[model samples]
Target: MEIKEHIIQGVRIAELHSDNMLLGSVEEAVDLLGNMYYNQADAMVLYTEHIADAFFDLKTKVAGEILQKFSNYRMKLAIVGDFKQVSSKSLQDFIRESNKGRLIYFAETLEEALAQLVR
Candidate 1:
């Protein structure tokens, strides 16, 4: 797993990347949050582009788990991507509702995700 941190418009956003499945289960999701907290990031923008191509079946579950973990830690999360490609309506609804909350968001672009985090 590779976690990179960046400050955009004063918001600390960490971009996480991994060849391994980052969130195959709830425990792994918790571990990722621990890493993010240790890094002292206010929000995370996980770059799953590579993983998405490699492990498509796990995407929604992984994303949902991350959001759940962040909520438990009182941390914030924003996934930047074009989510329309995801064929699951349930996941789409999950994304929509998560975005309505203060801690979770699904943004179409990194800029928008950064803006959401900063606000």
Candidate 2:
């Protein structure tokens, strides 16, 4: 697992990269958010290209766990990249509704994701 911080539009966002499933449960998601918060990040952009391949079947459950975890902490999360390749319609709907509320967004581009986070 690797984490890097980057500032976009004056908002600090952390990018997390993992070769394996790093967020298998709500507890792990909460811990990740806690770390980002402590690191002064306004949001997080998860790069899941590699991990997705390993845990393709757990995407929905993982996404739900992450959303639930961040909702509890009131933290923002943005998943950046081409989700069309891995996301199902159900997951897409979940993403859309989650974005409509607040704190969670699934973006095709990092720039768009950052824009949402800074708002």
Candidate 3:
């Protein structure tokens, strides 16, 4: 994985880029968090395509576990994706609720994700 740094208003945000699934389990999520924390990142932007498909399935609890770690660390996260194409109402609702807060957001573009992260 490659992390591209973005500093906005003195906040350091790490934008993750990967060719493979970067978050497949809780352990991987924690590992990612550790890496970001080590880099002194206040927030992160990730593309949905780089995350495991199971993360979008509410039954898997992957999203909850991963997001909770970010919340615990007071680190913001923004996921860039075409969420409108998702068929699961539960996942859609989850994304909707997440977007209503400052800690996490589901955005459609890199600009949108960065904007949300800086907010």
**Candidate number achieving the greatest TM-score relative to the actual structure:** 3
What is the Cα root-mean-square deviation between model 1 and the actual structure? 3.4
Better of 1 and 3 by TM-score: 3
Supply the TM-score for candidate 2. Answer: 0.75
Question: After TM-score superposition, what is the CA distance of residue 16 in candidate 2 from its true location, in Å?
Answer: 1.5
Off by over 4 Å in 2: 50-62
Report clash pairs, candidate 2.
none
Give per-residue CA lDDT, model 2, range 1-119, as digits (tens): 78777787788888788777666566677778778888888888875563344223544566565567788887788777677775567656666786786698878887787787877
Give lDDT tens digits, candidate 3, residues 11-83.
8999999888888788998899999999999999989889998889999898999899889989899999998
- Rank order (by lDDT, best first): 3, 1, 2
All models: lDDT? 0.72, 0.72, 0.91
Question: Which candidate model has the greater TM-score, 1 or 2?
Answer: 2
Regions more than 4 Å wrong, model 1: 50-66
- Candidate 3 scores a C-alpha RMSD against the true structure in Å of 0.9
